[model samples]
Target: MQVIINGEVHDLEGQILLSELLERLDLKPGRIAIERNLEIVPKANWASTTISDGDRIEIVHFVGGG
Candidate 1:
């Protein structure tokens, strides 16, 4: 399946939840915001949000710095 993640196209196998994808990308769940198909996914729903083929995903991370 092909999906666009953060402006890049990626080919993934099978379906995966948003949380799983975060882990695969080595990102911290608590510090990131996920948008799937132009809709923002709530944190509480991340675990149950399943990603399908041709879905567009955008992951944004919050960085702390002064």
Candidate 2:
């Protein structure tokens, strides 16, 4: 399956949950927000949200600045 992430196309072996995708990307759940197909997905729903082919995902990271 293929999904568009932050404007880039990524190919995956099969369907996976949003949380799993984050883990595969080495992202810390606490430090990021997810937008799926133009909708904001709450952190509480990540584990239950199943990502499918053609899904568009946007991961926004929180950065600490001085």
Candidate 3:
């Protein structure tokens, strides 16, 4: 399947869940925010959010530096 991630296109395997994608990107669920197809996916739904073809995902990582 094909999905647009952070403005880039990627070819992924079958039924890729949002949590799985976060793992692949080396992201920690508690430290980042994920928006799928214009909707914010709650933390509880990360594991259940399945990404499909043509879905647009925006992943933002939070960093602390001051």
Candidate 4:
């Protein structure tokens, strides 16, 4: 599947759920926010939200600084 994440194009194989995608990216679900195709997907729904071809995703991760 070809999807655009954070403005970059990615060729990911097979059907991937939102939660699975995060795992593949080595991202902790609790530390990030995801917007898929202009919709804000709730963390609890990540497991069910599926990523399809041409989907646009925006990811924002929280960071702490001293």
> Please, what are the lDDT tens digits per residue for candidate 4 over residues 1-66?
899999999999999999999899888767678999999999999999889999999999767878
- TM-score to true structure, per model: 0.87, 0.89, 0.86, 0.88
Full-model lDDT for every candidate: 0.89, 0.92, 0.89, 0.92
Determine the C-alpha RMSD for candidate 4 after optimal superposition of all C-alphas: 2.0
Please name the candidate that would achieve the greatest TM-score relative to the true structure: 2
User: Against the true structure, candidate 2 has what lDDT?
Assistant: 0.92
Q: Which stretches of candidate 2 lie over 4 Å from their true place?
A: 63-66
> Which residue pairs clash in candidate 1?
none
Residue-wise lDDT of candidate 3 within 1-60, one digit each (tens)? 999999999999899889999898788777677899999998899999899899999988
Worst 10 residues of 2 by lDDT: 25-34
Between candidates 1 and 2, the lDDT winner: 2
Q: Write the per-residue lDDT of candidate 2 for residues 1-66, one digit (tens) a residue.
A: 999999999998877999999899988887688999999999999999999899999999867788
What is the full ranking by lDDT, best candidate first?
2, 4, 3, 1
Error of model 1, residue 42, in angstroms: 0.3
Report the Cα lDDT for candidate 1.
0.89
Q: Which regions of candidate 1 fall more than 4 Å away from where they truly are?
A: 63-66
What number of clashing residue pairs does each candidate have, in the order they appear? Answer: 0, 0, 0, 0
lDDT of 1 by residue, 4-60 (tens): 999999888898988898888888877678899999999999999999998999998
Determine which window of 10 residues in candidate 3 has minimal summed lDDT.
Answer: 25-34
